[model samples]
Target chain A: MPALRKGRCLSPILLALMLVAGLIALPPGGRLTANEPQARLHNVDIREFAFMPAELTIRLGDAIVWTNRDFAPHTATSAEGDWDTSEIAYGQSSRQTPTQLGVFDYICVFHPTMKARLIVTR
Target chain B: MTPIKTTLLAGFAVFALTLPAFAQAGLDDLEVAHAAYTADVIDIEYAKLALSKTKNPEIKKFAELMIRDHTAVNEGAAALLKKLGVQAKDNDFSKALLKGFEAKKKELSALDGAAFDRAYAANELAYHQTVNKIVGETWIPTVKNGELKAFLSQALVTFKAHENHAGHMVTAAK
Candidate 1:
């Protein structure tokens, strides 16, 4: 009974702290709306001469950040030559928000063997 | 012996003497940096030569890539050395690399058009293979500095990718 009481007593306090932490972690100008999904940031790491996630799927409004974790420079360039995150150097990053919904193939212009796919959905 | 042949043999003898230094386990951080930078410069020079001689778009593009990537890697190496407040030390391995480069460059310079492209691509394949092996199996393991070791590890990945690309170029140039 005592342990049960302690659990009941801490639940609301812990919930309040988590809520506050979530609010603080929100992006600038982000609002918690009940009817709409929030845009998110996804990371794609370049390491060991390859992309961490060779394929990715994200929502239309979400952004993808390609971080070059390798010493050599890399780029996230669309195979169709439409979008390019030109030269993300070592320990650097670049972000791209997809403007259309479809599957897009990309490669590092420097190392064409580095290929990946991005699927943007509604 | 003919003068050019004699000179070539003497150059090879000198380069062979330096080969042990390259294979020895005593390479310091600065020596490794010097060798890595020298390799970059050699590749860049080869690429520049290729660019000047080749009209094939694929070969031209590969040459441009070599110039861009090698220059970028060299710049990164320079920045890291400056940040560490150290300079790359000149060593026998770097000297040997330059000596070999001089002869190879002269050989490549004598060719034009397809022959030049094929030779350039073949050299790139061989060069990247050698550099990648040294950086991965030799320098990265023996480097005493943490930052330098990490830098060499990252550079090895890039160079391995270059090796693969160069292999493709060799096939395409033929």
Candidate 2:
């Protein structure tokens, strides 16, 4: 009976070692699992005195990032006084995640001529 | 010629020659307005050159802002002049400013790439600073017309912002 119990324990240990070995033998590029949650992201490049895409459309719950590629500082200020990213410096980024669905117009207070629109859809 | 007649003729010639200089010396409200307008034009010109020559996105953006804002200011000045029944007069100071800008443009045109961007940014910073100082200290105080003074005062706000922006660019370039 003692020998039988020892055999049972050794069999489980061997099985566990085989499973770990199998995992190690798998290809480097192979994915172990899936079903991870990832947030949707959009990028707006502020370049050449204007936003590359002056208008951006996204779905609700999605996030948009503005990257300033200019030498000077800029701001994304809402026309209606709703939201504002005070100042985005050179090579820096600012993000906005809008919950509401509508068309929003924004401009740089420093350069009022620099305007852009963001549209969010449900 | 008689001595008295010769002296009178010399006096007349002196007065005739010096009149233009005297007119330019103390810029009246009209002349000051014209000079301000001309300064905007000069800034726009330099910005256009920068836009054409620079590949750096930051510098290009700055140049574009300069062009757009200065053009708007110029247009506003034009409309105001038209409404006020005033003609923008060319004066010695404005002429000298343009000449200096021409030299600066030549210097900038000779540079390329990063060198061009740094030089352009530095020049912009200096230009805005000088303009801000002139508008705030000299032009604003000396302007005689209420409307013109109000315009200059408003313009000074814009220029101060530009000066701050340019200062940032200069620092970033370094």
Candidate 3:
């Protein structure tokens, strides 16, 4: 009887974890916030058909933030990469910390021509 | 479950879990959208890089469109994330994909004139089609949020048109 009860309880817990895991598996960025250590104090502004600072630099532990100030919506995304906030919208911001040190480039999803670069370093 | 319960459950699941909850959370659906979201952004960057090196007018035009459309979607998504309170992501998969795209872009950019145009268009067509399939099969069914569902749906429509146009450009170039 104890064993049966234990099994029942355990399954729901496991089931719950699995569900959480599923959502976590979604791409980065769509679920990002303005505050994340990955891109510490990094700012991205969307205006005039371009993302300002087409080139930005931040600490490895820091983040790069994008705020869509343009009349049109714009996303700051990595072409072949993933991000905490793969995209950002007007009057909104997203952040992420680059785990590694290198130059990362991203573009606005709506307007691919609007590209920007993030240089993450120690 | 009753509609009210279902809606409640779905809402709770989003706060407690993630996208396209297959059984309850539809994690796969969210992943598909996330993946496409990631891929779209990556493509946008690639398009920019391609435009800089390529001389073709049509290709340049397409790159510009990617910037505009992707920005809207990303921003819309960011707004939702804010409401959800879930943290933004910078996972290994996204990092690696960007690296690969950069390498490929470098290789493709090495070509010039018509060859460059042909390669760029070919890549765009392939990328868009794959994204369409992933979103259609994995994302649409999994997503439970009413607003997010609608957003993805509209994005897909725009994406399909973009793919069609890219295909036309590639074929015309050839």
Candidate 4:
């Protein structure tokens, strides 16, 4: 009878332990941990009238943040009028996350000579 | 009206009408060069003050750019003047602009921190706007020399960009 009671006690404890393990295995936000890739952030600095990395390559869904370190205002204006960062003042930043796969050429509307290329790939 | 008084009034009216014309006679190549040089110098002077007085990184960067770009412009103007065998001549407009800049510098020096940044940025915006207008509307049309006109035209493009940058600075300071 004592052994039977001990088994009865062990059953709930085992169930609780199994429940906790299941909870731990589940991903945060209850989302599926399957084939979804994570997005990433990349930084591009503007200084001395030019982008630090004048050309950048990134995968789709990745974001690029452009920070203006120069005293003058700058704009990341797309050549095809697809995207623009308006006027990024000194020490200010703007972000662009390209969804399409293509090469986007941009220039500072204020400083036409300032140019950069962003390539997005699958 | 009495005859002498009428004559005097007519003379004054003639002077008034011609006064605008005289002022609108616009700057000669030498005066234009001088004005351009003086303007750059004034910008550099104010920028140096901004650099020393402000702690904001944005304003400091702007001040540095002002110093760099204006210095380059001044050097270019000087070289152009030398190449053309023309001596820069001072004019009433340039003198007044210098005086205004001096007063602005004094006012800006009295402030600190964000106040200084705001005032400096606003002043830069106003200054560039005025310069852009003068270069585009007055100087470009009235400049008699071919090279000088082209120079003013080119400088107008730069001034327009500066004006836009200054406008951004003004908003950022606010």
Taken over the whole model, the C-alpha lDDT of each candidate is 0.80, 0.73, 0.62, 0.73
Model 2: DockQ vs. true structure: 0.02
| Candidate 2 residue spans exceeding 4 A from truth | A1-122, B1-24
Per-residue lDDT, model 1, residue B27, is: 69
Best by lDDT: 1
Q: What's the lDDT for residue A11 in model 2?
A: 60
Query: Candidate 4: lDDT of B6?
Result: 50
Q: List runs of model 1 lying over 4 Å from the truth.
A: A1-27, A30-32, B1-21
Scored against the true structure, residue A121 in model 1 reaches a CA lDDT of 92
Clashing pairs in 1: none
TM-score of chain B of each: 0.87, 0.85, 0.73, 0.84
DockQ of each model against the real complex? 0.40, 0.02, 0.10, 0.03
Locate the minimum summed-lDDT window of 10 residues in model 1 chain B.
B1-10
State how far residue A76 of model 1 sits from its true place (Å): 1.5
Better of 3 and 4 by TM-score: 4
Interface RMSD of 4: 7.7
Query: For candidate 3, lDDT tens digit of each residue in B1-174?
Result: 445334433443342232223213334434444655686787788778777877787788887777776766676666766676654455444454455566556657677887777777776776677666656766676677766676677667667767877888888877
- For model 4, the superposed segments whose C-alpha errors exceed 4 Å read A1-113, A118-122, B1-25
Candidate ranking under DockQ, highest first, comes to: 1, 3, 4, 2
Q: In candidate 4, which residue pairs clash? A: none
* DockQ, computed on Cα atoms, for candidate 3: 0.10
Work out the TM-score per prediction: 0.82, 0.56, 0.47, 0.56
